[model samples]
Target: MNKNLYIFKNKKRYRVNVRNYNQEDFEDLIDLQRKAFPPPFPPDLLWNHEQLTSHITRFSDGALCIEVDGQIAGSITSLRTNYANESHTWEQITSDGYITNHEDDGEVLYIVDICIDPDYRGLGLGKELMRAKYETVVYLGVKKLAGGSRMPGYKKVRDKLTIEAYYEKVVKGELDDPVVTFLMKSGRMPERLMKNYLEDEDSADCAVLMIWKNPFIT
Candidate 1:
């Protein structure tokens, strides 16, 4: 709620701006995606301005773009779904006779994507991007926030305890990530969801599905 409109850091300080996407915004959006990911998504997905607009238009509250010095530096997309009665949010888990959760007006906000240019790493851009999505979801009266995050490797071992440790001790439900430290700090992620895996040639990459219940506006 600073409303001062920018986060001032050292030399590489970055400010995040949230705005609805226009058809003209596709190229820069795709460029931002390429700069953010290791294996960037296909550019053909947003081949034209119209294609970008169509993607943005699918969100319940529309997509948001983050700009640093008048250029697109990052972006986030959120989806609102009627999961009021559905026990499981994952499409892979839902089954027949599963009383389809009816929002009856209630809805859950799913953060589909959050990305930041590599050049902007260590500047807290990813955290800001997440905060933006959280604020937006709160404004929309969503009751739960959820997402799936990819781990670097399936069986990768770390000298560190785990991402969950950090989540439990530091963040304390204020934030969450698939990395065990952050996710555990934010909230406990269900093992049932965490164990869900995909096959890879060398090793399978583990993904953790996380959920944070909104204490406010519920």
Candidate 2:
């Protein structure tokens, strides 16, 4: 995993290794996580390379980090699971509980989280991080990808209050969900899948689940 990779630069671009996290990258990642999150989680919670790579290699589907201008800019984590016979199914939008007569042993991918520095926002770094995850999932034979978000309760109040309020007032407006916008722009998600998604944290929050059927999975 010690290979060199390069990203775009203005006058001159420097080359760096785009690889998995090691012991040395912990502090850098912690800083990035703090800047990316509104109320950043404690640094001690972030696992070291040995622990993280073990989680990915064993239970998780994919874990990745990006190096921009010779520094860690963002990261993404995803896992595989099957959700066929859960009895009661919760809707993605509206947070309504429902049951469907559907069944499949489909391979699922869960996007744990993703983040980039505020200065690096809108530079397509997040998209690249997502692409990295998608590629990993596609390679790993995962049929779908899903992620959960806070409705508008403690996580929101502790984090970005303004962004949370915007979602409440606008209700699915593009101004609030850049992640959804990214998924749509990539053509990886269906517009119809946004149903049952929660608006606030009170009831039940919806997780944005995107499915990508492998062309060779059948």
Candidate 3:
């Protein structure tokens, strides 16, 4: 696929690209977290030097960034792992976002997170990032793409519904959640519901384990 992409929105064309993260992108990545996820999304959970270092050093192929007008506008970090009918927390699976658990023999690609600069949201950059992820799955010959998606929308109805019920409603298209809706529309299927998966209060500290199988794989 072409590394550079062009899009026209609101009558203005914008240059965009998705590529592997480089050493120079560190600062931009740090600031992006603040721009993408603000207050109530714990600042302490944001990426730091050490964690990013592990992403690039250990699983460089999965450490990707998207550029808008040559500035780092978004990123998706992931790792490799082998798994089955088992349960694990976000920290346990991703090594607290450092990807320290990357396994060379791992057949599954697990996404840690994807964040986009608020300024670049409407440009469909997040979809571009997912496009790259699917491509990566095919390229790596992995069984599928796996990730735990946080449900920020559940918080508003926590007093009215259980997380599982909320998740079910979303899956059945009875509700529209910013995050979960995006994932489902992107072709990811819900695998399971997890508790205390992350620290986001919006999700009530819950997450949905999701997957997209690689059709290219046997």
Clashes of each: 13, 9, 0
lDDT of 3 by residue, 1-218 (tens): 33798978989999998899978889999999988989989998899989988888998999999998888899998898996337888888988888877997789999999999998888888888998999999999989999999999987899999988999999899997888889988889988888888888999888888899999877
Kindly give the stretch of ten consecutive residues in candidate 1 with the minimal lDDT sum: 94-103
Q: Model 3 misses residue 37 by how many Å?
A: 1.6
lDDT of 2 at 201: 43
Give a tens-digit lDDT track for model 2, residues 87-183. 2123321112111211223376655556677876655676666666666667677665655443333343434444434444334543434555566
Q: How does each model score on lDDT?
A: 0.51, 0.50, 0.89
As a TM-score, model 2 comes out at: 0.60
RMSD of each: 6.7, 8.0, 1.3
Clashes of 1: 13
lDDT of 3: 0.89
Name the best candidate (by TM-score). Answer: 3
Which stretches in model 3 have alpha-carbon errors above 4 Å? none
Ranking by lDDT: 3, 1, 2
